[model samples]
Target: MKQRNGSIQQSKLKQAEKLLQRYEMDTWLILTREGSDPSMPLLIGVRSVHQAAIFIRQDGQHLALTSVSDKGNYEGTGLFSKVVVYEDSMEEVFQELFQELSPAKLALNFSASDHLCDGLTQGLFLWLEDVIGAESLSSLEISSEKMLKELRSLKTEQEIERIQQAVDLTTDIYDAVFSQMACGMTEIEIGQLFVEEMKKRDVCNGLGNPYDPPLVCAVRNGLAHRKPSHYQTRPGDIVIIDFSLKYQDYVSDIARTCYMLKPGEEAPPEDIQRAFDTAIEAITQSIYELVPGKKGFEVDQVGRKVIEAAGYPTIRHSVGHQVGRATHDGGTILGPQRIPPRPEVEGVIQPGEVYAVEPTVIQDDGLPCILVEENVLVTNDAPIILSKRQTELVTIKKNQVI
Candidate 1:
């Protein structure tokens, strides 16, 4: 485990170094005031320093600047190589460092298009401008969004392992729910059951709130991304579950639909079954074209075409997105419009990238919507589905249901 953790850190460091080299940047400055509140939320790892400012140079050097009160906390992390403790003037400290390094170009976290790149607040930006002066501030440039995208897009072996573990645990929860789903249970009840199971297994919701879990189960309103309400499951009702388990800071998103059976009914309505099958086909077809080199929009088109051909209206949302530390992480997304339009995204898909393929189909009546979501990892050959795909609709008998 220790070796694996070390390997992941090394991989991240190597990627950071390569990004610096690619951009021809002299230094990458990540200034943060608090530890848990990192420069960017996605970069906040276990080794992150709190109540300190961190600086990473192009030469793979780390320097942490913090006050005496928070110096001990940053030092305890043992992540930074050089820990510089300051007593009351960050401006003076930064000036001295600026004079010494005097990098031709300093890359700061600021981008108009990318949310991750825009981590630096407006107030912080003004402060930085004041300290660095107008000339030096103008010389400072924004870090390429591609650098941030690539750094987060490529998952290390440990990250993959943790995500896989989360997938497996979620699968178990699905199985357990499948075995007990029955008519008369409210959507909230079943959603709570999933949370209970995840808690039992020591998994947490990525939202970081212990009291509230990240479980969204909607009956008949699957098309709407709303929370589960007090509506109880009735015969012929479709209950859709959209959930994920956060394990070791990694997340797994999975969605499945369950059908409530009437007292004498043995199978779901043919139309319901057809909708479910069409959703599955859309999801499977989307995965087929999820290779590295293809444009993200192209992959989305594959699924949209499948659904449209099946006589269903196009899904309102994107086919899928890249998943990592946060539920929605990274720049390259498998959606209708690929952001940036860079050739690198068109570059062949490499191993170690994980994504979630979610395809939804709504009935003409605007009633229940069938949604199938599964996490997948892009390999050299083809994408591997991490979460178990819903092969058939889960049926819950009236009396036998939870």
Candidate 2:
């Protein structure tokens, strides 16, 4: 399916406004240059402004301060509400805003823990501090996390549509790979093929685009995170393809492993098959126990226990993480480490939140590892799988010969 840009739902904006109010912040400012870096995702949804300093004040005022040279570029974008062209200094613009709004507390993007809040560089922050002056700067606080997290975690109808399209396209690519997969194909060849198909489908949209395609193919029996190499696939080898695509800035991650077979070969090594089955069980258990009120660590333990009970090594990574603009979008993760018993995460698994439940397991011998991942959307009762999950091990043969 051809992917298109999705609009940000007004409901999400309202939700954000409510969240800001809850945080007790009177005004929020999203100040950035060119609206590219950390603000790109948010600005992309904006319908007005261009080449300007974008500001979304607390009183619901949207201001765009830009240079005359680039005013035309943003004027037609329909992203900003008001445009202010600055030929020299932005001091006047700042002064006017300060006097008009006179906000008690101004929220700036600067979080020590979250990368999303750190989008405002040190230099730009200094400039903003100077612009606000000593008194206003003191009133200005760094607590944009609430706004950033709420904006990203809550998806709009349009954003959901775009993400669904990306998920469908990824499923199609997987089907195509399954049809032409062979035992002798090298890992690089497989990865390149996936990339070619993504481009043909025009799936490049948000971060890690054409340069770092979401689809990653790796052929390592035991190494889960190894980069794709030129190593040729052999019979009985376990091949894994871990990939995702960013649709309208949101991300979807999926992974599947296939077993190659020699001519006349009916099955994989008994041990490998056992490991694969165990991994699948872990995933199933994890999904079954996942719910709105449960802690992330609790869900992770369900999966971890399954693998350990099967006499397999525990997965080094978390069971899964929240998926959004960035692959590892901000919010609580479904892992043992992040989801501790005490001081639990604040939010629940809302219906709109998207996640990846990837359960991994390593066999005792450490030769072959099994991993299965799928994107899911939380519902009132059960989570719905966005990408098709691999139920059985895929078998690829050297040729069609007898």
Using TM-score as the measure, the top candidate is: 1
lDDT of each: 0.72, 0.68
Clashing pairs in 1: 35-50, 35-51, 182-401, 292-349, 293-349
Per-candidate TM-scores read 0.90, 0.87
- Taking all chains together, the TM-score of candidate 2 against the true structure is 0.87
Model 1 alpha-carbon miss at residue 23, Å = 1.8
lDDT of 1 by residue, 78-105 (tens): 5567778777778888778767777777
lDDT of 2 by residue, 29-95 (tens): 6666645347445544432233245565554555667777667755655555677787777778767
